[model samples]
Target chain A: MSKQVHRTLSESQVTAISEELNEPDWLRELRLDALQSLDELEFPDVIQTPGRTWTDLSKLDFEALVDPEGALEQKERVAPEGVEVLSFAEALEAHESLVREHFGSVVDPQENYLTALQTALFTTGTVIYVPEGVEAQAATIRTTMAGQSLFNYTLIIAEQSSSVTILERQETADEGDFDERYYSGIVELVAGENSYVQYGSLQDLTENTYNYGLKRADTDTYATANWIDCNVGSRLTKTSVETVLSGEASESQIVGAFYGHDDQHFDVDARVWHENEHTTADLVTRGVIDDEARSVYEGVQDVGRDAWNTSSYQRENTLMLSDESEADASPKLIINNHDTEASHSATVGQVDAEDLFYMKSRGVDEHLAKNMLVSGFFVPVLEEIEVEELREDLNGRIQDRLAQRTA
Target chain B: MAQLEIKNLHAKVNEDGGEEILNGVDLVVNSGEIHALMGPNGSGKSTTAKVIAGHPAYEVTDGQVLIHLDDEEFGDEEVPEELQTWELLDLEPNERAALGVFLGFQYPAEIEGVTMVNFLRTALNAKLEEREELFEGDESEDDEDDEAGYETSPMEGAADEGEIGVAEFQQLLKEKMEQLDMDEAFAQRYLNAGFSGGEKKQNEVLQAAILEPSVAVLDEIDSGLDIDRLQDVATGINALRDEQGAGILQITHYQRILDYVEPDHVHIMLDGEVVMSGDADLSVKLEEKGYDWVREEVYGTA
Candidate 1:
């Protein structure tokens, strides 16, 4: 067999990004290893039926060069007392061993093709560490991704009996001249025993960009992990979010929302594992698509054989604004233990004609009434979001999209 | 005086295998009068209300429902002293609503995610816009109105160019709720979502109070309502007619609600057309003897 440079990112460029991150030698080698794995790893597995697939990842070309020194612009925020919010570079400077212990610990580097690409080429990241028994209100991180190709990584660690809320938002740089671009994001959340971790994220990329994101958390005994992820933009987006209830009596809730328009496509997958006894989970997702846009959703609630007395439920609802738009969903529940209680449901439909007439009969304009219902469609998931500012932002982003469509 | 004239109206539910519902029904609701159109199932009473409101479900096959909107006082000018007569069939439902037409639903749509406050506020803005009362862009700031107790044309106040100010809207909604003896919590809930049967009926009346339409066609607002709720809703309807001086067309299957509301005229509908018309005694006789008398009296049957 002939040896060819099948990978787009090289060892030298991976090393360059690592050096820019101020990492140690071992971490640099890990980046290089991730770069080598990029060729072997494939895109995340997408569901397919006889007639069609939700998102055609095969058409996604990786021919764009990975910028060695991409835009890493993050607004600096001060951490609350007893909490540490530091850039990865600063984390290495002050808490070197802490970063080494937790980095790449929760998320696998070779989990998928995009994960490997982000693992190898990511230059900007942050670590939020809360020790035992610390109670923090909420911290916000806002950043902009620019250039031809960009990658982002985030690590959140909450210790025993501690509680913290992190709300992070990433937006596309509007002034950039890049015609077609790619964005990859990976998030790892660690929840210790009796702890509570809420991570809320919003991604509003440019329509010329493609986005791939994966967020997963591991829960300990009596620990709670909640994820609120919203996707608002991008030409194409495929996100996989997961939670593992590894400890007995652990719990998790994953709430998601997405709004697509102008030929945008989104494939969202959410999964929860009841690995131990007495664990519970709830997966709720709602989204809307319009103007030839499309969306696909897959949710899984797996109750292992030892998951006795567990409870898991899943629900997904989609609303379409335009007749040309389409949506599909698949919700699955695999209950191995007879003692467990589980249910799954999915519904895809257009905006209710009766609802529109009701509002209009009361004197709301047709366009405005449709926009109101669309805005209201996001409320259930927005209420599930822990951070008020993030919820408001997502709501505003939805309105903006609706306004553009109305125009 | 404003008027709503349903002139030899004809309509059909084309989607339901093209079944013609309203067959040349004629009725005229003058300002400050209450008329009840009573019918059994499929008598086309509710369809009249929907047709008056220009509901999209039914198509207007022929005839015209006209709305007479009078001129109003605007500063030094009597804007368009000549009354404008609009054909309801030509107008959208919202446009008809803007011209002081209201239709109270029998089963109000339970729209989740839209709070009562938001829906009411949007409706109020539409009303204001129709009357050219919207605070012009870059005109008076809402702060001034709030400081002076939210006074602006006695209507939905201006928020930010083309919107009613929040404080003024709250003040208006509060006054209407209090007038209707409604709980303050109703403003925060999704529009009619999870509402009890009676609550949904009351909400319809409350919306009518807010919109202050010149002509209100209430369809089965009394159904599923207990006597007490029926009385409360009837009292609210009476208040709207007496205060706003609006004409009302009350559509009902049972005479239970008419007992409280007191219709000036009672019309019995058979098949798709009104066959007989009378005063309050006629309704009482129908309630006492049942609709078999009407079927027999009108068509010489039973």
Candidate 2:
């Protein structure tokens, strides 16, 4: 077993995981193919300037981080009526055709090294299926990491005219027990024609955890998919939330908020691709970094050549609480067609002293005043969350972080 | 005895302290009196108000602002001796506010995402907490062993132990908004965000009414108000003064607001000093003859 654990991934490990899950021959073949691409593919390019890697993925020791033989513990909330939520192994056994048809359809396994690694060695996953014309309530997936390394995958299929909201939370089981752990997750969402899907994710892993997650959605005609991502923990976190508008008249809104403190590092990227005519995309993200923490946000709004009359707007703002904290943002608008309307803005700033004095003059203490400002800073994006519980949950977590700062 | 006194106050812009803005300024505002400070563009009327409120942009180079708290105004409990006389310049802006000093800004900052309800509640509760702590400390010093007995008893010193719950605060806000003829939805909106100039001034008046400060400083609160809104805001300010016996320091370049809210005393400020002081008719005189007359009267050349 020790000899089999080499720097480069072994095919036998891939076959072994697939066999352990009793996956079909096609899935086994896909895993082997993805394992082969790991050697050729490079980590996702995070830095645009040459000779500078803002978030260096090569520094991550994948050999020590990827445990192909790690145990998988899957726990999920009871599915809402007309909604079917199952683990990957259970889904492959009961709904093999549906699982095979939609899995990897939105996010290609060979997209990058991380994706390939996730595809080949994913230990635990969730599959949520909303039937046609069904308006299902929210389903929850709670992941608690208890091991040194864990890979997670989630696939959601909103059938025609169906709608569903999914809230996924990721955190460590014990506070400091899992001192050094690695987490990689992939979420693929497929929204059918006229369907709606809202995906809300809150990640509060322990400070010792290093996390990498990618969530992407594909929307059909008149379909809508909204993504709300809140990141507040982890020693180093790199997440990308993207949406592809593949159907005409479809809309996608990506709202993200993050609060980084201590020495944590957060690299957040949100993107939307307008692939069809008359599609609309709105991306808004707000974050606060304090202490010695650092955050970098990149937002991209791309209007393809054939996507006429595409309306895309992206805005990202990062508020720095401490002078020692650092933040940078880059919002890009790429319009390939002349008929598209697109705008992008990014701003990095500290709390406005005038606004602070204004509140303080009203008798609000300085500490509470700062907390209120930080809380209000996130309101623009928090208001975009369609789920009431999720919005309140995010607000509570923000308050907790502010309290920690005061403490 | 309950008054706000500024004695030979000297202040300057905090950045570099280039020149004194308020030089040897002395003024006294007693409870139940309205004093209008009229001045020209560069005469430092607004700077006085900001300095009194401990705005960080202004540095108080000399002199002191003393605030005397009225025991009956806070509650039936006796005010602590130490809490009675507060040095405004030594305290933070919020501390000054807690001691019943309110400054109505000329250009109120538009704070996005902070709802009017939330902001008002927090401010009001802070003041109440200050009162509660002072009263509690006073009562404990008088009766230490019986302190535990008063813990569960009805709070005669404060409204529910210095904290107003959401429903009660909303109700209070609604009542105050109605009194000011403000739209009910204004309470739910972000604090001063996207508000028209008149709306912003009216909101400031509403905040003053809610907080019920002992000395309310109005710095060009009537600048952007229309005739109707000016009358309404002036009416609200008058009501606050009448109901709470609050001292009013109305600072403006024009005497228009003085027409609606009558002032007992009017002072002309020129070159950062109170050059001339007179009765209400002084505002009418300045309105008709302009500041040239006051400038000539004080400087002997205009």
Candidate 3:
């Protein structure tokens, strides 16, 4: 076999990033190992029919997207009492032991090619930890990407019986001089026994940016984890949100909403594993694609053999606003336990003509009627959002996208 | 001059040059009159109503729907005209609605995500926009008119010139719901989604009450309604007529609803055309003899 030359990044760059952060030797070694794995791993494989690959991730040019020396600027809000929100550097300085113990535990460094790239090159991130039995209102992290390649990470850990909500927003600064950029965001959440954690993420990068995001959570006994993810901007977005109900009676809910327009593309995947008895998981995702945009969604609910009496449900619906727009969805259920209850449904369709005409007949103009129907299509998923500000922000973004298209 | 006039109307399904459904139908509904259009299934009664409302599905092959507005009621110093005539056939459905033409659908489309309150408020605001010339001057004038109980313009007190405030719209919707004996919770529900037949019919009536259109075409609004809901909807329609002097073209398959709301004129249609026209007793005769009698009377054979 011939050896392919695939090292757009070098060991020295990885060492430089780790050294710049003044990380411990173990963390630096992990980054170096992840950097080495990038050459061997390939972009995530997408579904392929007889003649066509649905999402061609290999088409992305990683060489043009690598900038190991890019700067990272993040603005974080102060978390409430009983909650500790710190940057990666600050966390390492103040709570090194705790950060070393929990960081990269939920999301392994060798998860995938994109995750390995993120692990090796991420320049900005935050660590949020909630004390035992404490209830914290919120911790907010906002990032603005401006350079050619930017990688960000977020880690959230809720101790036993503790509860916390985290809101992370990713945006692109209005710097028109930059070339087509790339973004990779990695998020890991760990909820301890009887703990609660809610994570809401919104990514609104510019059209010239390609976004790759992987978010995963681990739920302990009687713990609950909820995720609300909204993606509206990007030239192309490939994202996955997942959870593992590792302990008995643990629960998780994943809610996702996205809007794509103007030749943009999105490939979203969500998965949940009921590994213990009586675990429950619900996954709901709704999106709208307009213009020549395209989207693909895959949801997987896996019930393990020991996951008896488990309840898992998944539903994904995509609304197409234009005839040229396209969407494909696959919702799958893998049940290994006879006592488990699992259901999954996926539908891809255009705006209901009857619904549009009904509203128009009542004097809502054509554009407004279409907008209303599109907005309404997202209600089922939006209602799953437990945070008020996040829900409103997502709603406003959807409305803005609709207005931009019609305008 | 305030009337809805349909003259030798011809229409067809809009798709693929579909076959004609309404063939040379003529009707005139004047203000303050309730006209009952009685017909069997597929007699084009609903088609006529949809065509008048400018539903996009039915193309008007050749027709003229003229809406004549009373200049004293609609005109202001802007144009200073005594009467206004609009060719509704050229207008879009929403434009027709803005011109005070409301169509209560036989099977009201269930808008899954839009609440009844939002839909009604938007429709009411559009209706108000159509009458912007009526309240063109200032807010003080509106206040004075409100103090005088808005006897001059009942709808003016319901909406502002641009957009109705949310609280004001809620209040207006509540009042209309009360008038129709509808539950206040209905406002929060999706428009017509999962609603019972009676509830859908009552919701249509509630929309009419809120919009206060000059002319309302109720297409089989009483079809699925029970006796009590039929009476409530009838009373609501009567209230619209009495309060706004609105002309109603009530289409029905049976004479059940006419018992609650008397019609001044009853027209029996068959084969896409009106075969017989008479007073309210005509409905009773039709109920007793069935539409076959009208077919026989008009064609000289059963």
Show the lowest summed lDDT stretch of 10 residues, model 1 chain A.
A1-10
lDDT of 2 at A392: 68
Candidate 2 TM-score, true structure as reference: 0.93
Assign candidate 3 its CAPRI class.
acceptable
Candidate 1 residue-wise lDDT, A137-234, digit = tens:
88777768767777778888899999998898878776668878888888888899999988898988888888889999999999999999899988
lDDT of 3 by residue, B1-302 (tens): 36899998999999895989999899999878999998899989999998998777888888699988875544442424433677888877777887778899888888776677766776666555544523343443433221111111111122233367668888988888988899999998888989998999999888888877889999999887778898999999999889878899999988888988899999988878887899999999999999778888888888
For model 3, fnat equals 0.48
Clash total of candidate 3: 0
Model 1: residues with Cα > 4 Å off, grouped in runs = A1-6, A69-77, B70-83, B133-164
Error of 3 at A106 (Å): 2.5
Candidate 2 — which residues are off by over 4 angstroms?
A: A1-8, A48-52, A72-74, B17-19, B70-73, B133-162
Tell me each candidate's i-RMS in Å. Answer: 8.2, 9.1, 9.9
- Ranking of candidates on lDDT, top first: 2, 3, 1
Compared with the true structure, the alpha-carbon lDDT of candidate 2 equals: 0.84
lDDT by residue for model 2 (B1-302), tens: 36999999999988874678999899999988999999898898989999999888888889989998765657666776766887888888887888788999888989877778777876788766655644465553442221111121111111233367767888988988888899999987888999999999999999999998888999899997889999899989998789888899999888788889999999989999999999999999988999888878887998
Q: After superposition, how far is residue A3 of candidate 2 from its true place, in Å?
A: 18
